[model samples]
Each structure stands twice: as structure tokens, then as C-alpha cells.
Target: MTLDEILDSLEHDIAVRDDGLFAGRAIIDGRCVDVIGVSRGAFVGVDEALWLSAQVMETIRRGGDTPILVIVDSGSQRMSRRDELLGLNECLAHLAKCLMLAGQCGHQTVGLLYGHTAAGAFIATALATRVLVALPGATPEVMDLPSMSRVTKLSIDLLEDMAKSTAVFAPGLVNLEKMGAVNATLDPAQPLAAQLARWFDVQPDRADVRDRLGESHGGRPVAARIAQRVYELARHVG
Candidate 1:
């Protein structure tokens, strides 16, 4: 689904603003929530990050039991000398912290990924959400396979073959689900608004269980065990 279609489906009432930013009040299952959409894909810079941070902060300041819906389609962080000079990393970190604050203040955060979600853009925005849902055929990745092959010195064909069977380093929505990075995948033909309302009504606020889910799905067998061992060691030392 495109950004506009998703918004139209999920939001009974919405107003689109200039420069790929939009805010609206939505009612789901008799509960009201605030929705924000950022459509500036390809590259998200400091200004965009700060704008998102402010939106999240304002929601927390309002002090209501309103959930936050973030519609993300960004590909990566902006690559420019000016953005770097202006502390892009710091801006992204601030955005992440703002989302974290909203969660701490009892705001349920949900991310709907309808397009390209990659690298720092994914981490600073969508990955910060409490529940992440992706549309069918949406690709979320750290880096493209060719780039990964260059970085890791693996052959492209080998990586492709590995991706066919294992999702440890693949760049697809199904792979993300297998690794527990994505909570659920939505069918495009289904009623998106009703599905999202059901998710909002039923999904619980809980600690990250991606590792456990990954193990259960047989994608990452040792991650949970390794984490437990490290925690045990730390407890013993302390």
C-alpha cells in the first residue's frame, strides 16, 4: 500500500501537511489516537528527525492515554557533509529517545511500514516503536545484499543462496518476520483500518522478545541462550 492509501484506510479523518509530514487524530475501536506520517523517503536528515521528535514529545506532553501511529517509508539517513556537520547522528538519537519517552509515558506506539525501510532510518524511527507491522512485499533491511557482500567479503550468489533458506541476513519482510524484527505482516487486500484497530486493541506493551521469537522460529538459536548466559555471569559477578 502507498502512504496515502494507508493513511486513508487507517485514518477516518486526516489532514496532509506540506513537505511530506502529516498529523491527524484517529479513532480506533472506540479509542482515540494520534497519527503521524513521514513520507520523505530515500534520505531523512536532521530537520526531519527533529520534526518527528517534536511530534512525539507533544503527544507525551498532552498527557492522554492516546496511542501514536507512525507511518514510515524512509530508506536511510541523509548522506551529506552538511548533515554530518550538523550532527545527524545526534538528531537521530534524539528522535529515538523521544519515542522511548512516549512509551515510558504509557503511549502505545505502532509503526506501519508501507515502503522502503533501511539502515539508520529504520532504527531511528520505525524500530523504536513498541509494535511494528509491515505491508506485504515491503522490504526492510540493514543494507542491500550487494553492499553486504562487499562489506562481508561474501559472494553475491552465496548470499542469495543463503537468504533462500535462512533469514539471518536477508532483506525481505518474511525474513524480518522470521527474525522477529517484524511483529506481523498485513495482507493488502484485507481491511487495513480494522486490522490495525484490532492490533491496537489487543497488542500488549511488553519487553522486547525478538530474541526468544527468533529462537522459537529457528532463525537465531543461540541469541537468547547467549544473552541469558551473559546475564547470569553478570549477576554472579555483581
Candidate 2:
């Protein structure tokens, strides 16, 4: 097995042994939030990510901050042919939307990954969060390099190079860092709850290292600045 696959396999084993759910309580810089994650039971399969959407909304409705820390370890999909056939994109989009809603509603969405966090599995966790915490051994690649070659008809080496850039379609933590996909590549030994508590306390508006990443490496902030200017101009014009 490749180094990446081995790491992912180890993570998948550990998560399985640990049993998937870890719930915790803390005040993130005085903002009350109940952090939630997954491991076992009802939360399995391709449909699993969708389950958390309502839970997030309900947390907001109750005047409580309910941030989700997704513990991703599953492969792309196995029994999800039905999901794909039945418009899986929309299903996945709804889940992504819900995670954004949590972020917009003053709740922090976090992704903690080990094992193989690939497929829709990658998007479900990575795209939703304001901050992401991953172990050094984690394999965040979009797909094993060979799969991309088959689908895209590009040389594996070229595809590997492109995936390295976060601004491009590069998967994994390093690429995600540039695309503004993940906020932090944290130490796995630090404990999930403790790290979440720390970032949660830091208000999202302030530019942290993660925010600076997009601005510095990818020049992504240029677009944001333009958007901000457009909004201001529209307001004055109106």
C-alpha cells in the first residue's frame, strides 16, 4: 500500500475502534457552543453527512451555537448508487449549504480527519468549516493519483502538480490551505476539543493565519476586496 493509503487505513481503524461520536461543551470566547462529531451508528453511509444538517439548524433555533466537527474516515461511497442516481449533487449541496448556515449563524464548523477523507467525504467536511484540524498522517488527496489520470486523461505527474496548488483543484491539507479550504493543519496529539475551543474563541472576522493563507499564497483576497468594493458601491448607488 502507498504511504497515504496506509495512513488513512490506520486512521480508519482507530476511528472505528474508538466508536465515532465525541460530544463536548465549551464557551468559545464566551460564545456558547456545543461541539459535535461522528463515529458509529445511524451516521453511516453516503447519506450520513446530510443527517447533521437539521441538528445544526436546530441548535441555532434554540439560541445556542451548534458547531459541527466532522470526523471523516469513510471512502467515497459504496452503497451510494441510489444516492448518485437520485441526484447526489443536490443532496451533497444541501449538506454543504447547511454547514455554511452553521458558520453564518455564529457557529464554527470544523473538520477533523484521519484515514481516507476522499470523495464527497472530502467536500462534506472540508468545505463546510471555518477551521479544519488534521493529523500529519492524514491523506487529503482528492483521489489516489492514478484515478485522476484515468478520468482526466492527463499524465499522473501533471495532475499531481496541479493538485499541489490550493487555488487549483489540489486535494489534501496543503492544497486546501491555499484554496482557503482549511484553516489549520493542527497537531493531532493536541486533542480535538481543546483545539476547537481555542479557534472557536477567536472571532472569524479577524484575519488569523488561515485567513492570511488565502491572501498570501493564492492572492485570493484580491477577489474578496473587489467584492467588498462592489457591495459598497451598490449601497451608495442605491
Candidate 3:
């Protein structure tokens, strides 16, 4: 579905600004949520990252226990020499921290993957949410398959064949679900507003469970083991 359609289904009285970030106060089944997202498939830059951070902070400052709904459609980070020179990574990190702080401040953070959710854009925004739901056919990937093949020195055909059997290196939302990246996938034909309301009302735990879910799904057993081992080592460290 288009961004506007999604927002209309889930929110009422939407207000969009000139900055490319759209937000509206949504009331779902008596639950109030602040829904915010970037539009026009905007390549997120340092400035956009800072804007997002400010939005999350301001939501917490408002002190309403309002849930934050993040709508992600970004394909990637902006490709600008100036952005990189001025510390793009640092800006993205700040955004991630602000999202985390919002959760710590008692807001239920949720993300809806509507369009291209890829690379640093996903990490800085949607990936930090407490619960993430992806629309059917939405592709969320670390990188495109050809790019991954080039980076890993693997043949494209070989990677494609492996992706058919395993989701660890695959790119679509279905594979992402198998790897326990997204909490759930929403059907486009179904009513998303009620589903979102239920998700908000349920109030899932904020703790990170991807590693455990991945292990249970048999998609990435080593991830949980490795994390546990690292935690054990850190516990003994001075």
C-alpha cells in the first residue's frame, strides 16, 4: 500500500509538513499513538537522522506515554561526500539511541515496513523499534543480492540458490521473518488498523529477542551461542 493509504488506514487527521517527515496523532481502539515517517522514498541523511532523533525526544518530553509508530520506506542512506565527512554514522547512531531512549521513557515503539527498508536506513530507524511489522512484498535487506555477492566474492547464482533454501542470506520479508528479524508480516488485503491496535494493546516486551528467535527458528543457531559466550566473557572481565 502507498504511504498515504497506510497512514489513512491507521491514523486520522494526518498532518504533513514540508520537511518530508509526515506525522499524525492516531487513536486506535482508544489508544493514542504518534505516527511519524519520512516520505517520497527519501534517502535519509545526517540532517534527516537528527530530525528523527528530535521527533522521538520530543514525543518523550510530551509525557503522554504515547506509543511511537515509525513508518520506514527508505531505500538507503544518502550518498553524499559531505554527509560522510561530517559523520553520517555518528548521526545515525544518535537516532538509534534516541529511539531506545523513547522506549526507556515508557513508550511502546513500533515500526511498519512499507517500502524499501535497506542497509543503514533500516539499522538507524526500523531495526531499533521494539516491535516491527512488515507489509507483504516489502523487501528488507542488508544489501541487494548482487551487492552481497560482490562483497562476499560469491556467485550470484549460488547465492540465489542458497537463499531459496535458507533465509540467512536472503532479502525478502518472508526470509527476514524466518531469520526472526521482523516480528510479523501483515497482509495487504486485511485491515491494518485493527492489527496495529492489537499490537499496541498487547505491549510486547522491549528486550531484544532476535537472537533467541533466530536460534529457535533454526535460521541462525550460532548467533545466540556467540552472544551468550561474549556475555559470559564480559561478566568475568575487570
Candidate 4:
């Protein structure tokens, strides 16, 4: 869906302006949300990352505990020598930190994935949100099959077969949800307004619990135990 379609689906009163980036306010179900994101599947780079983090900080300064809605429709980080020279990795990490900071400061940071996104762009945007909701037809690729094949030194065919058996490292909504990356999946056939409102009504506390979710879903059965052990050991040492 287009950005306009997404805003419309929320039954929101919003005014989104674009100057190579999208930022705006959306009032959904009488709840005001600050919306910021990229569009048209653009490749995120230093400038885009900085803009997003700045928007989050601006929202934080507003001092309302108002929810932040990060709408994502982007590709991976820019893969140019110039972007590398400009400290793209640090910029992306800053963006992610800003989102996490918003949540820590009492804002409900939610991510809406209505279009394609992958890699660092995905991490700095959607994955950083406290709760990530995937819209129908949203495509979130963790790693392209070819890239995964190259990285793991496994054939693309083998990866495909493995994906059928394990949600880990796969790139679909069902797989992502199973692995606890996606917190919710919006149903277009339902009243989107009510669905969103219901989510806020029963939203979980802003704590990182994906590891537990992964264990329960059997997508990552041992990760929670490993994390618990690591946390306990670190606490003991401290």
C-alpha cells in the first residue's frame, strides 16, 4: 500500500509532507502519534539516518509520552563508498538508539511495516521499535537468498528448503512472527482503526521480550535460556 493508503486505513487525520523524507502527525482512534519514515524503498544512508533520529528527538522534546509510529518502506543501507566514508554505520546505530530512547522515555514506540525493507535500514527503523506491526503484503527481507547463500556458503536451494523447516533467518511475515521479530500482523479485512486501538489498549509493557517469545514459538527454542544464563553470569560478575 502507498503511504497515503496506510494513513487512510488508520482513519487518521494527518498531514504528511515530503522533502525527500516523510514526517507528520497522525491522529488514530483519538490518539495522536508522531509518524516518521522513509518512502519509495529508498536506500538509507547517513543523511536519512540522521533525519530519522532527529525526528525522534524532536518528538521526545514535545513531552507528551505520545506514541511514535515509524512507517518503513526502505531498502538496505546505501552501499556506496561515499556513504561508507561518511560513517553510515554509526548514523544507523544512532537512529536505532533514538527510537529505543523514545521508548525508555515513556513513549510507545511502534513500527508499521507496510512495504519492503531489509538489513540495516530494517534494524534502525522497524526492529528498534518496542512493538512492530506488519501490514498485509509487507515484505521484510532479513537477508536476500543470494546474500545468505554467499554468507553461509550454502546453495540457494538448500536455504529455501531450510526456511521451510525453520523460521530463523527466513524473510516472510510468518517466519518473522515465529521468530518474535514481528509483534503483530494487521488484518486488512478488519476495521483497521479498531484493531490499532485494541493494540494500544492491551499493549505490553515496553520491555524487550522477543527472546521469550522466540522460545515459546519454538522458532528459537534455546535463545531465551542462553540469554538468561548470560544475564545471570553478567550480574554475578558485576
Candidate 5:
């Protein structure tokens, strides 16, 4: 199938009921999303993120080894008035905070990227132990190249020139690493759990890496800081 065809299915999705706990068997490195949808109510991305996060905590309270595989085939956040006012960044930050706590609780979170991941939504997905990605098929960026060029009103040619030896200007896996977005890319054909198992071995230290991400970019992304603070507060409050 063509790229557009592959990317099309993610646009409109159904939600599954997870009872607030993202607990279930995985695809063995296969796509976990297809197995788990809304699990509660509407399949809207931001709300779905919020729900799963709450579930993750419940699972942790119950026991050990809650290794959840969050397969990311998402493109971007749905544009909506409520979403804007509700603060998409806040919703995403909520999920990232949960994922970070999951790690501290001895859970291994893994994300298998199968499509474009950008902005705060991208940040939410990659907040894992070690991110396993597909081939060139998956695109990771803080802000995609086109958007950056368009919003900044800079020419694509000029941006391409900057990305020549620097990732600050481009949007890709390599560029993301330079920006400290994801940990590693996986071969599209590799099984997901196997990769996650490997990641479980060489886990990406979340807070440290996030600190680097923020340091490299001058300030951490707002969503990132919120998540960090959430964890910290949760610690003090508890």
C-alpha cells in the first residue's frame, strides 16, 4: 500500500474500555493499539491518553511487571475547540507523568511507532523506557518540518540547509535524537515484545534524558515540565 493509504486509517478511530488499566497481552512486538482502542469511551486521542494513564496506575497498585506496549501510529492531535481550550498539552502531560511513574514502580513502558508523531502528542508517546520505532515509515519530530517552515515562514530549502549537519532544523529520527525525543528505532519487521525486552535491558533513563532534552532546547517543553512536576508532587503528597 502507499504511504497515504497506510496513514489514512488513524484519522477516525474507536475507543476501547480498559477499565482505566492498560493491562493485557501484547502483539509480541506486534501493534498493541489495534488490540486496545478507546477501552472506555470515545476514541479521541487526548482523552484516551488521559484514561490509559489512570489505568496504568491501578495496574501498578495491583502488582509487578506491568510491561505495557503502547504502539503509536498516531499522526497528530485532532483540531477542536474543546481540545484547544481543555489544553491538549495538559492532557498529554498527564499521560507522560503516568508513564514516568510507571517506570519508577518497576513497569517497563514501550512505544512502537508506525507513523508520524509530532508536538506534545509526540512527547506523550515517547515517554517510555526505550522507544522502538519502525523503519523510515515512522516520522518523529518536535514540530514537523513542513509546519516549522510554514509557521516560521521559512523556506523549505533554507530549513533543509540547516538540517544538513544539524537536527535542530530538520524533523526525523536522527534529528529527534539530537533533540532527545526518542531512544532507538526498530526494524519494521522486528517483533515488538522482543524489542521491548531489549529496551528493558538498556532502558532509557527518563528524567535524565528529559533533562537533556530540555537543556539542549534551552527550556523543557511545557508539557514535559508539567509531567515532571506531577511526579514530584505525587512523591511529596504521598
Candidate 6:
């Protein structure tokens, strides 16, 4: 879905201004929500990441404890010498930090992935949110199969076979959902407005719970345990 289609699917009154980045307000079930997003499936570069960070920080400064909805339809980070030289990684990390900070500051940060997003773009936006709500057609991937095959020095067929047995390294909604990356998938056929309203009423407060969900879904059985063990060790040392 296009950005407009996704917003329209909310079945709410929305007023937005866009300049590749979106900042708007929507009324869902009579509750006002602050909506922000990246448009055009952009290849997130340093400039885009920094711009997004500023927008989120400005929302934080507004201090309404307003619920935030981050809509995503983006490609991976820009793969170019210019971006790298300018510290793209730092900018993306800053963007993710800003979102996480918003959640910490009493804003209920939710993500809506209505279209394709991958790699750094996926991580710094949707994954940083407290709850990520995905639509049916959305695609989220850390790495595409072909790219993975190249990196791992395996044949595409072999990588495909491996992916059948492991959700840890593959791309697709099924794998990502199983790994607890997607909090929920909204049915486009249903009334999205109602479904989203329900989500707002019951969304989890924890900023990050993917590890626990990963364990429950059996997509990543040991991640939670390992994380806890590491946390305990670090705490003891501290």
C-alpha cells in the first residue's frame, strides 16, 4: 500500500504534510495520534535518518504523552561511499535511539509496516518501536536471499534449503513474525480502524520483548535465555 492508502485504511480523519518524510495527526476512535513515517520506499541515507530523528525528537519535546505511529516503506540503508564517509551508521543509530527515547518518555511508540522495509531502515524505525503492527502485504527482511547467499558463500538453492529449517537468517513475514519481530499482522480485509483501536487499548508497555516472544514462538528458542544470562553476567560485573 502507498502511504496514502495505508493512512486511508486506518479509516480515520488524518491531516498530514509530507516532504519525503511524513508528519501528521490522525483521529482513531476519537483519540488523537501523532503519525510520522518515511515515504517512497527510500534508501535511507544519513540525511534521511537525521531528518527522521529530528522529527521524532520534536514530537518528544511537544510533551503530550501522545501516541506515536511510525509508518515504514523503505529500502535498506544507502550503499554508497558518500553515506559511509558521512557516518551513516551513526545517523541510523541516532534515529533508533530517538524512537526508543520517545517510548521511554511516555509516548506509546507503535510501528506500522504497510510496505517493504529491510536492513538498517527496518531496524532503526519499525524494530525500535514498542509494538510493530504489520499489514498483510508488508515485507521486512534483514537481508535478501541472494545477498545472504553471496555473503555466506552458499548457493541460492542451498540457502533456501537452510532457511526452511531456520528463521534466524532468512527474510519474509513468516520468518520475521515467528521470530517475534512483528507484534501483530492486521488483515487488510477487516476494518483496520477498529483493529488498530483495539491494539492501542492493549499494546504491551515493555519497550523490547522480542526475545521473549521469540522463545514462545520457537522461532528462536535460546535467544531469551542467552540474553538473560548475559545480562546477569554484566550486572554481576557492574
Provide the clashing-pair count of each candidate structure: 0, 5, 0, 0, 14, 0
Give the per-residue lDDT digits (tens) of candidate 6, residues 1-238: 5677778766444444344667777877777887878767778889889988988899899996878888888888997999999999999999999989988888888898988899998999999888888888888998999989889898999888888988987798888988999878888778676777766665446536798997898788999999999999999999
> Which portions of model 4 show Cα errors greater than 4 Å?
11-20, 202-206
lDDT for each residue of candidate 1 in 1-46, tens digit (9 for 90 to 100): 8876776665457776566767778876667888876775657789
After TM-score superposition, what is the CA distance of residue 174 in candidate 6 from its true location, in Å? 1.1
Query: Which candidate achieves the best lDDT against the true structure?
Result: 4
lDDT per residue as tens, model 3, 130-180: 878988767788788899998999999999999888788798787777777
- C-alpha lDDT of residue 60 in model 5: 64
The digit string of per-residue lDDT tens for model 5 on 123-163 reads 66554434444445566667866888999999988888877
> Per-residue lDDT tens digits of candidate 2, residues 1-238?
2223322322122222343534444344344455444532222344555555555666668765555555555455334677767666666667677777777777666676655566665665555667776656566655666877898899988877776543545656666566565666666554444555676665444223454557775736675566667779999999
Local error of candidate 4 at 11, Å?
A: 5.5
What's model 4's TM-score? 0.92
TM-scores of the models, in the given order? 0.91, 0.67, 0.91, 0.92, 0.65, 0.91
The CA lDDT of each predicted structure is: 0.81, 0.57, 0.82, 0.84, 0.56, 0.83
> Top TM-score: which candidate number?
4
Clash count (model 5, backbone only): 14
What overall lDDT, based on C-alpha atoms, would model 1 receive against the true structure?
0.81
- RMSD values for the candidates in order, in angstroms, are 1.9, 6.6, 1.9, 1.9, 8.3, 2.2
- Model 1 TM-score, all chains together: 0.91
Q: 84, model 3: CA deviation in Å?
A: 1.1
